[model samples]
Target: MIALLNNLKTYLPFSLLDNKAFKRIEESAQIAYYPENTVLIEENEIPSTFFLIIKGIVESKDGEELIDIYHNDDVFGGIELIKNQPSAYQYKVNEELICYEIPKEVFLELCQKNSEFKNYFFSSIVERMDMLKERKESAKMADMMLTRVDDSILHSACIVDHTMPIIDAITKMENESAVALLVKNESGYGIVTDADLREYILHHEEKNLTIISQIQTYPIISVTEGELLFNVLLLMTGRSIKHLPVLNAEEEVIGLLELIDLLSHFANQSHIIHVQIEKATDLQSVIDASKRIDTMIKTLHLKGVKSRYIARLVSEMHKKMYAKLFELIFPHEWHDRCTLILLGSEGRGEQILKTDQDNGLIFEEGFEPKDQVEITLKFTETLDAIGFPRCKGNVMVINPKWAKSTTKYKEDIRRWITSPGNDDLMDMAIFFDTFAVAGKISIFKDLRDFLMEQIKQHKAFLPHFARSIESFESPLGLFSRFVSSDKGHKDEIDIKKGALFALIHGVRALALEHGIHKTNTTERIKALNDIGYMSKEDAGDLLETLEVINTLRLHSQLEKLEKEKEIDNYICLSTLSKLERDTLKEALKTVEEFKKVVSYHFHLSMVG
Candidate 1:
């Protein structure tokens, strides 16, 4: 009884229960044993008991296919038992199974008495990942960072004496518009920003506010004028700061190195677009704000910002647009009732410009499709007005298949895993890549966790999933010379299908297998590398390859857009410089190598 109580406390909400509740569960629970290969629950079989695995592996198989594996310290049958619904698969004992089977009456009683326990079974929602994880500081110009930091690169500092009033320093910084002040204090030098001033105000009295040095950060990260520009960047990034004091050969404070200026080397008005999106109250205003994104993308790309960074910024802007649009259109009451999610490139944060809308919505369990069908339809239409084309596959929230409660969607996904059809496979791929953009994101998290759990049980799913990497032929030829399309676009390659798709989908498969929950290809690669799935050298090669491929794809789309032609993924091979073509060839080779790696890793040899 003591050992069982301790084991029960190891799981959540059970851990929340008092000694009395523990005693109740212990007294009611019955230990049950089963031989290997025992079928516990068949298809459509509603279990009357909740199971806590003490020792064993129970494989949940859809027909003959192993779909999921439940191990010790895991609970099962809660969903079917609570909903009084048929189970989707047969639960078979893979080994001699030992578990505590608690009757539904006992389980339901505890659930009724404990809101937290009830939520774990029903909602399963809690705090999740932030929409934007803290971002690492990035500079677009790799070679530019190598340039020596000279006076020309420096922004003039607002020099202030230590004796100067705090208000005077504030006025100087404001007047300069973009700068940190170099404060000459008796206790040596320091740097201060308006942010520093605001922080000081919180802790000190009004009279102490007049003292300027009190707010300045002493010996703040600084760099010499002749040091490499990247040195400043590294310092600022490491310190999580924007402003740094630049010093001369004699250690004389010369000016400030602002991160924004260091990155764009020119004023970036992208923040203007963000402010517009945020401040927009009406639908048209939000639509109008979104129009500026394409122009910003062009400007950033032209300014030599890395395509990856541009995509990250664009993804952020797009999410803001989505959240803002939903805020304007959806009823305030429904705001917390649903989560907006993006699919395809949009979902992966690789979306630069879109050929279609790649978005959906996940409603809480109680939400009815009929109640807000018109609003969901209008939301899709409004996005269309804002320049996103309708998805070719109709994956938008307006589609009943895409817009539904988390429970209904999970059922569809479970079916998708079991179906051998290509369309269902495609649907599975799309769903796996979803990223929540707006609403009570817990809705998306609950659904995502469900998918992951299902994927865990379905052992045959990934190998078959990994087989889709073969959908498109490798871009390289017999000798790895350029392989151009023979279709309407002559001498052109569909960079996405030829190169990007294979790399992304391959990485996606590996990520799923390793349970790396990240959606971005680059992030997934880094995570894979960190967890010893891929060597550092291989990971670095793939990352560089992705960067090159993304740059080429974006450049092609931009040029096509400029010509008023249909913007697409095709890259004109003849247009690339010999150096670029060579780099691309190398990148394509890396894709080929990685595909083979994924195929072998997933044992796709047996898949066919």
Candidate 2:
């Protein structure tokens, strides 16, 4: 009874439940035991009571036999009883079973008297429904996951020369299931299936068919062996074809895949990740891996690694794995055609434990790769699968706008910053902290040089970018007082959204105004002092405040992950210790100072 009550407590509306409530529920229920092989409930029978299993086991069966067994605090029958439906299936004793049977009326009275208990009951039912639905979807997905090209369909195919004799070809067909053959014709190739051979043999039709080319089918639907199973399935379904010839880039036939073979490979969570990474054998692999970065971070954190060091390791491995995946997918000839460039924190190899993909592509202009679309798509997809969410603003290489030849890319940047607009200035703001990750480092250096040259000469883009920085107001009131919301986040205030983004955006704008491209918030502040962008005292204060906010947000994220809750920038103000709340209040005050600087630089006059 204690175990059952404890488990019930987990689903209740409140996090904590008292011993008194548990004892009350326990005293009200009577424990009973049933012998093995006893029928508890039958399919199509109205359920009258809720059985909260205390010990032993009960089996649930559908049709002829048992499908599932439950033990311990497992609850059954309540859902059916409330719904007034025949039990979905039959329940029986798998072993001698011990349970607490609560009558329907008693259960209803318990819910009416206790709000927490009611919430727990309803939530458990909803959760069970959701779990069942998820199971069904998971099963469907698993079935579709093992998509492969069927070899049986391909077994009916053979590549043949046009000069083969009809009789010899017919004899060959008898030994091999190859009902069809791809034969070289004057234009290209033709396919002749088993039916064509039968017609030729039975009707004595076209014995002089000197070349099987005359009747072979033209064109073939084919894919590389490394193609994603999901994609292969999609193609097969779209084209309504069962067979796809597998070929190497050199156009040499490696094997043939049929729909049945494709469908045989089941989709497991790990399998999707494995396939995505494998297919990302080009620039596309890294791009795809970048998308799921947050999930990857959370998973790693859950495995009990320290946060700070984990970020560095995750970023480096991310780069290395992406490179490896690309190498696997790229045709051998084009392996050295381009270099990947990592910008921002990634370029500096200083990424600490957060999801950020700041990268671009640089390749020789004339390279004009044939598989550009396919290869890059694989890259982006892999990144997404591995838990790196896609960048909403498009800083990654999968965006064609960012994939540029070295020369063209440099020229584009030079033009954007020099001739600024709202969009142009924003683009330059992103490029300010760019750093090289992979590929030809020289191209990135040249691009940077062109950008700096233009920035130095133009001198106008900075203030425009700076002007837009003050859009986020500091969280303080008229007399520099900490403004607490009367009805804000249920019990907590999000320190990140309310404090961090505001500070980071302000500091970044200030850094760009001074042409200081340091990516780290702390480093950027120190840079501001060195260049006289801000006084030493102001820099020191701002840096301290920003660090505190960053630390709090990171801790909050870690906490949320531990509880299996969704993460956001919000910090619960109510849960904070007194010292932490005071620090956040001070951080907001620092942000107010930041607003003044932004306003002065942007030359915006205050209103009201």
Per-residue lDDT of candidate 1, residues 1-608 (tens digit): 56876766635546657787788888898899999989888889998898887888788877776656666666788888877899999999988999989899988888878866766665411110010010101223453445677654455578889988887877877876645677897755888876786787786685456768888888677788888866766777788888878888788888777677566533343675676687677887778778768767876776666788999998899989998988888888888888889998899988888678998888898876455688988998898887888988898887888888888898888988876578888888888889999889988988888888888899788888889998998778864456776579887898989989899999998888888888999999999999998899999999988988998888889888889888888899766633356567778988999889988888888986
Off by over 4 Å in 2: 1-337, 343-358, 478-497, 513-517, 531-536, 601-608
Clashes of each: 5, 54
TM-score of each: 0.58, 0.47
TM-score, cand. 1: 0.58
Task: Write down the lDDT of every candidate, Cα atoms only.
Answer: 0.79, 0.61
Q: Candidate 1 regions off by >4 Å?
A: 1-266, 369-371
TM-score attained by model 2: 0.47
- Cα error, candidate 2, residue 337 (Å): 4.1
Residue 135 CA displacement from its true place in model 2, Å: 40
**Per-residue CA lDDT of candidate 2, range 63-147, in tens?**
8655555656567776676567898788999889888887777666665666655655455332433333333344345434454
